[model samples]
Target: MDNDTLLMVVAQLGGGSWVWRRSGGPGSSFVRHQALGSGHLRRPHAVASARLGGHLYLGVADSSKGGTSTVFRWGSGGFYPHQTLRAWQRDTHLEFLELGGRPALVLCSAARRPLVYRWSGGGFAPHTDIPHVPDVYAAKHFRLRGSVFLCLTRFLGDAKVMRWEGSMFREVQQVPARGSMVFQPLLLAGHRYVLLGNDFAPSRVFRLGAGGRLEPAQELPAPTPRAFVPLAVGHRHFLVATSFKGATQIYAHVTEDIGT
Candidate 1:
């Protein structure tokens, strides 16, 4: 979202669309600007938006059984359909990242291998696939100790962490997980940490170790955890965890301790 515009994408059960709103300032009310989509969009699952070279790019995923996903570009007067990409049974997440100064899009699915597409001046093109990443529900990219890493969360098996090895991403570590869906990265007291959420197991926190590995730090009480985020109020910091089948929890920051 920019200072003058707010972009939002909606996933309709049958058809999906993207909307843009414009506001006068920080506290002003926003008015609808425009909406765009294609008739082929069905069960849209995720939308990733990015701005490059003064233009906006949007990647939308459709999870319908045989529906194809599409990328929209801002042109002429509004967003126009750009590229249509094939997705699997369920496209769960879409992430936008810049690797080696090139814009890229990462798509995650539950039945097909995770795909990465690079922006090729004219349009986005298939770049590579994350091998063995079936059942992937989410993907996150973070930098640790001057190195970039990609973490893929699976809903049936172990979550894998891959490091960008100059040319491509290579698997570096795996964290035991079951029904995992999200990986939330946070920084606390000069240290990096990752919170793993599983749909059928207890949530966990992993700390960056000496050799770039992640070590178990703490276990959360979340049953069927789904999402996590770091929050701050006044001078106190807190960690919030949301569960799909249990109560939401808030953890306070207690020097050297990851709140209970």
Candidate 2:
């Protein structure tokens, strides 16, 4: 690791957000660094971290009525509030990605279409909007064959797969995902897969199939899963899933050689 300090920001729905830092190497416990927006933050939904110009920045999104999201920039002393973004009271996710080789942020909301903001040397500025999509719970980006794609999870309707063209993103695929909350795309064992988590149904996994289309592959018992993270140790692969109403599950990836 280039830096010895690891920073994590936690967002709360009722309380404010907090920044925790861990110094030194492995097994170092994290310590609370600072608390922010104690009386102002309400129903914070998500927190995102990014590195720009060798500096770390953290953003928190809130979904309560009249709530606003805030971005903090790290300084020599500590992290301080750098910018405030409008959350529209229904923002559900904050995603940091690279768009056109520049740092960008996407704010997904249930109230309206998702908005894209690009870093403008000093702060993030509105760049575009993902039109005609509403009630989105989360947005995740993945790269395939030198192209970037976005998977959007909808709370009411079908989930969508969007491809980024020169200037904007266009819908290319849709999966029936009513009541879905998370659509996480990950690369595992040289293959690409997407996990769709639903509140009313079993979570489904889709693999990248022929012609770059997503094909249904398997199902998991994690209902109302919020996130999926892929991990590898030695020659084994694992997947960690967090559920909203159940215990967190860890799954092993085993390849079965079925004779043709």
Top-scoring candidate (lDDT): 2
Pairs that collide in candidate 2 are: none
Residue 257 lDDT, candidate 1, scale 0-100: 61
Residues 1-260 of candidate 2: C-alpha lDDT, one tens digit per residue: 23767777787765567877885568988888888666657888888889898888888777877787778888864777788887555777889999889998989876878888999999999889998788788899887877778999997899999888868889989999987889889988777899999889889999986545799999999857999999999999999999888999999998899999
RMSD of each: 3.2, 2.0
Residue by residue across 1-260, what tens digits does model 1's lDDT show? Answer: 34456555555675336464545656676564556675757778777788866778887877878777788888765777888886545787888888887888888887788888888987778888888668788888887667777888887889888887766778888888877888767776456888898776668889877645789988887777777778888888888888777789888877756689
Candidate 2, which segments miss by more than 4 Å at Cα? 38-40, 210-212
